[model samples]
Target: MKPDTSTIDIRAMALLIILCASWGLNQVAIKAAVADIPPVLQAGIRSMGATCLMLVWMTIKKKSLLEKDGTLLWGLICGLLFSAEFVLIYWGLEFTNASRSTIFLNTSPFVVALGAHLFIRAEYLSRIQIIGMVLAFAGILVAFHESLNLPDSGMIKGDIMLMGAAVFWGATTVVIKASPLAKVYPGKVLLYQLGVSAVILPVASIFLGEPPVQALTPLVISSLIYQTVWVAFFTYVTWFWLIRTYPVSRLAPFTFLTPLFGVLAGSWLLGETVTIYLLCALAMVGAGIYLVNRR
Candidate 1:
């Protein structure tokens, strides 16, 4: 039987917020890591590390490591989508400013909403949800309009790549909603993606042929660890858990927070510029999210 949304509990919300916060901080972590580690290599290593940990955990828990009930095909498909999405994101980051990347990347929610509306029976967005989505999109614009407008900024390339990445992520989620894999454990879902990414990223990194690890500073190492643990392990698992427990549509709107925090942190920590437009965008996004989810 399909799970009822009305039965969602407090633990789900707590998990959601924690995951969102980690994803928010993830942009900064990626930026910091990419400064020293080659972007592809960084992605590869992080995925490999996460995969190892997840596999170990799954083993201890005695979850089916070898895909019971013909789920391996679906898992492999999801993993391919997962791998492609991050590859684009990591490479895009090298060309783009983190704050602008976050703003543009937040476009994924809209794509997901649209996809759900078109494809899924259970995931409809009400008029209020639509309004909230527009508000959040507008908020992103407000938050990054100045940076976006600046001439000679490399942001154009990065923003494009991130936008593409968002679409990829959106499509992946839609597939998840449609696939039989939804019936499987969330841990299985994550493992498929991480394990595939582990193999794909490393091979791709080799072809990209990054220079030997030149200077692995403490900052870089810390950032990589943060991405591997908090972003990869904690946040991804939390996200899968939320998908299992809550209404996907209601919770997806909250993901606007990821980019909101990303923009703020980039400005504060990395000395990225803050502009009036961004402040206005942030206000609109917060208000929109509040209105949409207030029920």
Candidate 2:
């Protein structure tokens, strides 16, 4: 429970698995609804809904929403980075398969691991961990190779955009670890992100000339609700807690599992392609993550 701990206990592992599973499926949820709702508009609405939920949860907990804390500047910076991440992700999903998007986006751990090493004095990667990072990243390179060679050029574009989002996400983690936001309430940290993105994304949707609402099928609405309530609001709060409670380097390895779950979810739900190459990449990434965690 202490902050900056080097090891992950059983409770953290269990919650992390659950988080990865939900996140993996989250890509599928976005894709499922993409046909009915435009991507940026969908993301905007999800952020708005999740922001409302964040407000209510904080209010019920007697947390002050308007505290004049020093975190405002860093918090807004985090929010802007968070906004950029989702904008790219939702837009990327339009061009690539959910499985591919997941594979590329989860590369944030590399970004986090390296950034933490450079910025946070308490967090440094060991030689084994560095090796683990390379192996895991090699897996990503394998999948990325397939993307570039695909006849569909749009897939390459989407994959690159998702990778860009990974940088933003990784930067967000580093900022939270290195800045004043680390001392603030986790929900409020999330609130800053959700609130800022709620306004920016909808405006983005409008500025981009995306229609407000094209179709509202039951499944699409359910997907939006699930994204808003569970993935964005609840699980992300838990993620911030984990970040505050554990070493960022130690927590980085576990994210490799997310793409596996996402690939499976995409295969089952959207019938997206899943090649043996991707499976091999998953295996290598798993081994690499294990090495990173090994003492």
Candidate 3:
């Protein structure tokens, strides 16, 4: 059965905002955990933990884990993309600050919108959408204004990886839109992707000489719990619910707030400096979101 496409409710908007905000703060948590744990291992545990929880959820809901339909192939492809996205993001964090990472990560919108236009005929971008995309891109640049000025900080490489991660994320979005897995329940889709990522990341960590237990600490555990439970499972489920329940176009613009929240959370939690550039970037992104949402 297809989800109802009707009015966007206030609760959905609130949930979207909360999800974005939680995700924004989640970057800081992951960053903090990295100091006490290897990035890859941390990512692995987060995925594994979330996967386990999702499995329990599936069991409770009587949802089948195995897909009999052709959507299984799409699910695997989507999972591979998801795994690669986090692999880049987690590893890139080792080379860059959370704020800079957030900036580069926001580029996903551009990539996704472009991919959508090319592959999914349903998602044609209007002039306003194009302009909004550009503005959001500018906002990302603004968010990293200070870092851009420092050419000596080895930011070039980190920025590249972060940008690559964003591309992968965009590719995943395209895959989702085009793949038959789109017909599956979001929870089941997430479970499979997380399960795949959980398996892939840990093996990769081992191959990279990063043992799972070597990074285990109290801080690491707490961060993993938070990342798995709140960031991965809860936020994702809530966002999916909103998308399934509300007018997708009306709610889509709120996604731009995530990196803004990331910057703010990074500052508050990690004591990262928030500069005028970030403020300007926030304005630009907010305006871009408004434009994108305007019918």
Candidate 4:
């Protein structure tokens, strides 16, 4: 079937739903595996595996990796930002429930929308978008209000770290869109991220005193494989392709489903408690995302 030029077709919508589900399930997988492998170390290993897989895919597709693209500097920057983002995510997951972290991480869109307004003249946010951003920020506050009041709270720390990761994630998006990296092949764009993180994360894991090998249980191994293949490789590539083929404004709203799925998956798979605050925050953030992405 021919691709729709300006609208989301049934196939695209179905794929988007599937992609969101995979992403949500990924958080549960990480939570399950982190007991056997330290969070940063687990992330490092998964990135390393993903890097190799990306290389293999590139080879199969006959994609050139050594092209003298003027985007190398931007690629490296993106890699660093990408690495930092995941580092925070994996570490924060240690202290907070995966459901909570996912909610905070979904704030990246607001960050991106605001940053775009400031830097990209053509991408200014409307008044409705501004209200949406405020609502989302309020949701974050609602989610963290109690945790923040307690002294030396790990939950607060985790929430802050996840929020920082969301910022980095958004910044990475802005960089890719603004820099020459936008002109590079999407596969190579991903390769740069995975390759750089492959090196940086392992070293960071070592320095941070994370062991190279923990108890490699069946669950751990399965989680690692799922993350490497599904989350990092397939889902990410699909997202990049969607960005290329669809109106991002239309596709962006569907992202709200991800955190909802994340919360549900975490509660179901990990037996995490879903507090009222969390549900309230989810509702606000989900509504905000819709408004922010509305055209």
Q: Best TM-score goes to which candidate?
A: 2
Better of 1 and 2 by lDDT: 2
Clash totals in order: 2, 0, 0, 0
Residue 44 displacement in candidate 2 (angstroms): 0.8
> What are the models' TM-scores?
0.87, 0.89, 0.86, 0.81
Which residue runs of candidate 3 sit more than 4 Å off their true CA positions?
A: 1-12, 93-100, 150-157, 211-218, 241-253
Greater TM-score among 3 and 4 belongs to: 3
lDDT of 1 by residue, 58-113 (tens): 89989987655677887888899888887778777778876677677788888878
Q: Considering every candidate listed, which one attains the maximal lDDT?
A: 2
User: How many steric overlaps does candidate 2 have?
Assistant: 0
**Comparison by TM-score, 2 against 4, better one:** 2
lDDT of 3 by residue, 162-265 (tens): 89988888777677666665567778778767888999998877776764464567877788889989888988766655544443434555667887788799
Tens-place lDDT digits, model 4, residues 1-295: 8664466677877888899889879868877887678777777787888889989989999999888989788889989999999888877876786546766787777777766667653656668877876686676656555544442587889989999999998888777766676666788888888989999998888877776676888898899999999998998878767655654444555666666567678788878777798789778867775676555
**What range of 10 consecutive residues in model 2 has the weakest lDDT sum?**
142-151
- TM-score for candidate 2: 0.89
Candidate 1: which pairs clash? 142-277, 143-278
Model 1 vs. true fold: TM: 0.87
Taking all chains together, the TM-score of candidate 4 against the true structure is 0.81
